[model samples]
Target: MPQPRSHDIRRGRYSEAGRSYLLTTVTHQRRSLFHDFHHARLVIQQLRRCELERSCRSLAWVVMPDHVHWLIELKALPLGEVMRRFKARSSLALHRAGVPSQRVWQAGYHDRALRREEDVLHVARYIVANPVRAGLVRSVREYSHWDAVWL
Candidate 1:
């Protein structure tokens, strides 16, 4: 299969600071690397670190077996940059932590920018309820790798 060009992958996409976005990205080849609890926790740490680094405020997130969904309010950086750094940092940390991977994530990610009037809490609920929707768990409380401020 031919790999997509980077420019084509990011075309028609624009990132602005201070906007809330829901981002989703998969692992390389959709590997179930996050099935391990510790590895998934590492990703959660990096998600919070992105907030600590002033890139974005993590509103909600979930770590599935092969992908992640992150809802964040951007601080002063482009969403693309924030994601780039977040992925890179997490990949590095995971490697250093003795987690084996040829690559930590796929190159492109999906982002949906929220309008001012949109219900953020609704989105947060959707994010945290992914496990239930995926049949991974019977209840949100049973999911070990998801979080939302409202929950």
Candidate 2:
């Protein structure tokens, strides 16, 4: 089988401290059912554990049916450590829930660092609005599986 093409972001480059990122990850095979509101709640809980353990700051996040977008500020740990723990814990939770699969996430995730001049809050709003734009909800507030510190 052919290998998947890599995205533009450099992996493991942000292994140092003090980098903020907008990260995204999708379910394997684009399986929406794996990320329903209930499952997403569990995943969010796991993410919280990761944030607390790694001491990262979560600015915004939204969990869609098959994917998630997170805006976070790295504090004490490297960005890679945060993502690894988040993905690992969420996968374990899904497996415990009887997902009946070998994998829950794609091989890698996408991340982009925010420039100092950019509006971080605006970026967060865009992340939270994904459900509305996808027609899953009439308004972002109506979505049950998203949250942001600014909201």
Q: Which candidate has the highest TM-score of all?
A: 1
Report model 1's TM-score to 2 decimal places: 0.93
Query: TM-score of predicted model 2?
Result: 0.90
Model 2, residue 70: C-alpha shift (Å): 0.4
- Model 2: per-residue lDDT, tens digit, 69-106? 99888878777678878889898888887777678888
Candidate 2 to native Cα RMSD, angstroms: 2.1
lDDT of 1 by residue, 1-151 (tens): 9967766867788877888899999998899989999999999999999999998888999999999999998897888899899899889988988877589898888889999999999999998989899999999889899887665
**Global CA lDDT computed for model 1:** 0.89
Off by over 4 Å in 1: none
Instruction: At residue 57, give the lDDT of candidate 2.
Output: 83
Window of ten residues with lowest summed lDDT in model 1: 3-12
For model 2 the local lDDT of residue 78 reads 72
